[model samples]
Each structure stands twice: as structure tokens, then as C-alpha cells.
Target: MKDHTGKPVYFDEEFREISLMLLKAKTRWQIDQLKQYADEAIIFIDEPILSALGSSSYLGVSETETARLLKELIDVIKNEGGISGIHCCGNADWPMAIKCGPDIINFDAYDYAGTLALYPEEFRGFLEKGGYLAWGIVPTSEAIAGENPESIRKRFEQGVEKLSLHIPKDLILSNIMLTPSCGTGTRTVEETIKVFQLLMRLKEEYA
Candidate 1:
């Protein structure tokens, strides 16, 4: 890969190609599962690397190309009668991701809720077009120990309020879906259970 200055950058194109191949295979398998067993499917493309798009380490990464790649996969899912979502567990260029046209955007609302609010116009358009926001309010880290249902609800409301500055409060509220800040793979089973328990309680009390 080359940067804007025409200097070669470190990017393993072969690895990227293999990763895309794997992603496509997984996506197709999920679509087949939906067709065979369920009436609907929601597939989220977990893209943690997206958070590093504009960072110094990945300065040569092309936003346009990234969006095209994401859109390509999302379109395949959508065309196959599945709902496509993108989950980025850290702060990223919200506008660029929004423009990729996924049915949902899963974000780490527990930590980076305010980061998304910085791109009001993009969000407004996304919401108005029947898009959904998967608010990752339940923290998956050690912080989950300190949070209760009410506290998490309060934090979620704060995030909604921030976005409501540009979009209608009701619109934002109605379109929101709750999730953990990220996967609980690294957490203990006890902590993982606590995360889901809190998630259900928060949904029952507030959602």
C-alpha cells in the first residue's frame, strides 16, 4: 500500500485477501443458516481494526476503499435477506462507517458514545433511513462490577441525550438496541453472566 505521499506503507495484502475470503465464507454460512433454520438473521461484521483507520499506525489506509469493502459485504448480506450490522468496539470515523449503509451500527456506547455524536449529520441521515443503533452500554471489562442496571440505563440515556441535539430524542430512543461494550471472551464466566444479567435488567427497566 502507498500513502498519499506515494510512499510505500506496510500492509500485508495477502493476509487481507485471506481475511476477506474467510469473512465472505462465514457470512455465506450464516445466510444459509438463516435460510435453513430461522426466519431472520442479523449478522454483525466485527471490525475492531476500523478504530485504527486514521491513526498514525495506519495512515495509508484508504477510507474510500475501506468503505467499499465494507459495503460490498454488507450488500451481500442484505441482498440475501439478512440484516447486516457493523460492530466497532472503539472510536472510529463515524461518518465513514455510517456511509457504508449497514442496517445497524454497533458501537461501544459505554466509552465512546460521545465520539459518534461528533458526526450529527451522518447519524441523522442514517436514522432517518430506518437504520438502527446497537448501543453497547453494558461494559464487558472489570468496570461491569461497578455498574448496576440503573447506572447503565442512566449512561445510555446520557448518550441518547447527546445525539438528540441533532436528531429527535424519540427517534433515537426507539431505534436503539442494547449490547455489551464488546464480546465477553476475555471475561470470566461469572463476569460474563453478570454482564448479561445486567443487560436484561436494564432492558426490562428502561427499554
Candidate 2:
């Protein structure tokens, strides 16, 4: 495959081995953090890569393998007494993600909430099995400049309203969380601060 700069990248055997090693190391570190800090940890496996899974560039990637990898980590997290979540910053195969058996599903609700809503039956089953949905309603980009808590809240309610058509409103509401659309790492400090402030204000109202 070629990267954004069109540089050739290979997912050869050596690369696959290194990737697995890295994943294992990361998982161990997360488990240690869980053990050291809190009785229960909410660990999110942020896989922005899933957003590109079905794209032409990743057509060779197997969906089954992807699901297996996610489920393997999720199983370990749960077995170690942690809540596991998967965050995909863009639209992907929502049903596939759900089938991975994560305790939570986090998505860019600010832009792609409807994408998940399209899988009503799958989402309903997930929720019924005590899965949570982390709604990433706060924008992490310049778009944040045009948003406030009220607008964000309104958008969230609208998303819920759409999902409530097939799933019980109470079920959806009871198992929901809020988050930024993605990490704010690339944003300016001022923008990052605003993002948290908006998130806190929304949390206060909802709480």
C-alpha cells in the first residue's frame, strides 16, 4: 500500500510480527495501569484505522481478522475486570464493530451519529446486552469555533431521537456517554481548553 505521500508501505511478515508485539506490549501496559490506578478501568482501543478498513487502499485487509484482533483485546480487558471500548473516528462497518463484543462503542457522533443509527437492530442488541455508547458530540476541529454546549446538546438529542425509533429511548439514554469527536492533540491549546470546557458544561447539564 501507499501512504498519503504515495510512499510504498508494506504489511509484510516482519511488519505483522512487529505490529502484534506492539499490540501485546500496549495491552500489558494498559492492564498494569488498570491494576495500579483504579478498581475498574475504562480502556478505549482507539482504532481510527477502522475508518479506512473498507476503503480501496485497505481492500486486502480481512474484516474477520480485524474483528478477531479487536475481540482478542476486548476479551483480555474484560477478563482483567476492565471496561473495554472501541473508538472509530469515522464511519465503518458498525455491525462488525458491534460483533467484536466491546463493552462500549465510541464514534464521532458530531458528524457520523447517523452512520451508527443505520444499524438499529445491531445497536439495540448491543445495548440490550449492557453495552454503552460513547457519543463523541464535541467537535475537535475548527468546527468547534461555531459550536456551544446548547448546540451540541441539541445535536445529541437529535441523534438519540433517531436511534429511539427502533431502540427504547430509555435504554439508549441510560447507557450513553459523551466525548470529543476525536483526540484534540492536533488542536491549539486554546481550542483544546474550549473543547473540555464545552464538554464539562454539557456533562453538568446532563448530570
Candidate 3:
């Protein structure tokens, strides 16, 4: 195992390999199981096997490995008739996620809105397809947990303006979905509740 500092805190290559295999198996299993559930519309395969690092931190498989794993996972989702997505709140390789064949890319647009907007060509191309862009607009970080719906809504609206300049309004509206900057596991209960409520309000008002 390794920490964010990129230092090896633990050394067990054999166990690590086994763990990866188990994760791949479990992901495949969940993809299969999720397909069996009629109410399910999406299946997000969590690929944290290599991301033993933090969630937002930049980390992913090598090119060859990424292609292989993504192809297999995407195939599973396609066969199951479910929309696939990947949620990486922390910084990540957006291009790699796009190449993973996910129908949607869940990212923290609220924080790095400018970075994505800069790639108009690629962003437009992704939107031109039936792909969705799930924006994590709600602020969940402890430093800014006091955010309200109005504040979050404005943040998203600004992002929309940036994205709309490159992609058509109808296209952006049809495909955009709102979410929190990250999970609430690290937040207080009140903040977590506010996050969902704020998200709902934003969706309702905007949609």
C-alpha cells in the first residue's frame, strides 16, 4: 500500500495483485447484479483498486490497463442496458474517464469549473453525444459547509454559462445533472441533509 506522499508504507505485491483481481471480479459482479434490478437506470463501477490514494487526487491505470479495464466494464454496462458513470471528486484524468466509455462523467465542476470550460472542443463533443455531465455543485468541504442553495445554484449557473458557450443550451440542459462536490461521509449530518436539499432545489429551479 502507498500513501498520498507516494511512499510505500506497506509492501505486499502478491496481496495487492490478488486484491486487484478481487476488485475487478466484484465490479463485474455488481455490473451483472445491477442489471438484474429493474429499477436501476445507472451502474457506477467504483474502480478504486489502483486509487488507494485519495479520491480527488490524480490517479488512474496506465494507458494499456485503462483501455483494457474500461473496455471490459463498458461492455458489461452496455450489455446490461444501463448508463455507466464514474465519480471522482478529487482531481483526476478527465480524458481517461471519457475514454472509459461511461455515459456520464461525474466530476466536481463547482470547484474546477474553469478547467473543464477551457476544453470546449472536447466538452462539446462529449455533450453532442447522449453523454451526461453530472456536476457536483454542492459544497461539502468543511471549510465551506455553510453554503446554501442559492450560493450553490449560482455556482452551477455560472458553470452552465461557460459550458453553454461551447455547447447548445438544450443539449446542456438535457444532459446536466447536479450533485455534491463529494460524498457526505466526511461531513456533519446537518451539512449532509442540507446538501441533498440544496441539490433538489437547484434541480427543480433549473430544470
How many residue pairs clash (N, CA or C atoms closer than 3 angstroms) in each of the candidate models, in the order given? 0, 0, 2
Of 2 and 3, which scores higher on TM-score? 2
User: How high is the lDDT of residue 84 in model 1?
Assistant: 94
| Tens digit of per-residue lDDT, candidate 3, span 90-125 | 556566667767888777777777667666776678
lDDT (Cα atoms) of all candidates against the true structure: 0.87, 0.86, 0.70
What's the residue-level lDDT of 112 in candidate 3?
Answer: 72
TM-score of each: 0.89, 0.90, 0.77
| Location of the lowest summed lDDT over 10 successive residues in candidate 2 | 7-16
Scored by lDDT, the top model is: 1
Candidate 1 whole-model C-alpha lDDT, 0 to 1: 0.87
- Across residues 110-206, which tens digit of lDDT does each residue of candidate 1 receive? 9999987788888888988999999999999889889987898899889888888888998898788989999999999999999999899988976
Identify the superior model by lDDT, candidate 2 or candidate 3. 2
Candidate 2 stretches with Cα past 4 Å from truth are 1-10, 13-18
Order the candidates by lDDT, highest first. Answer: 1, 2, 3
Screening candidate 3 with a backbone cut-off below 3 angstroms (N, C-alpha, C), the clashing residue pairs are 56-90, 56-91
- Candidate 2 or 1, higher TM-score: 2
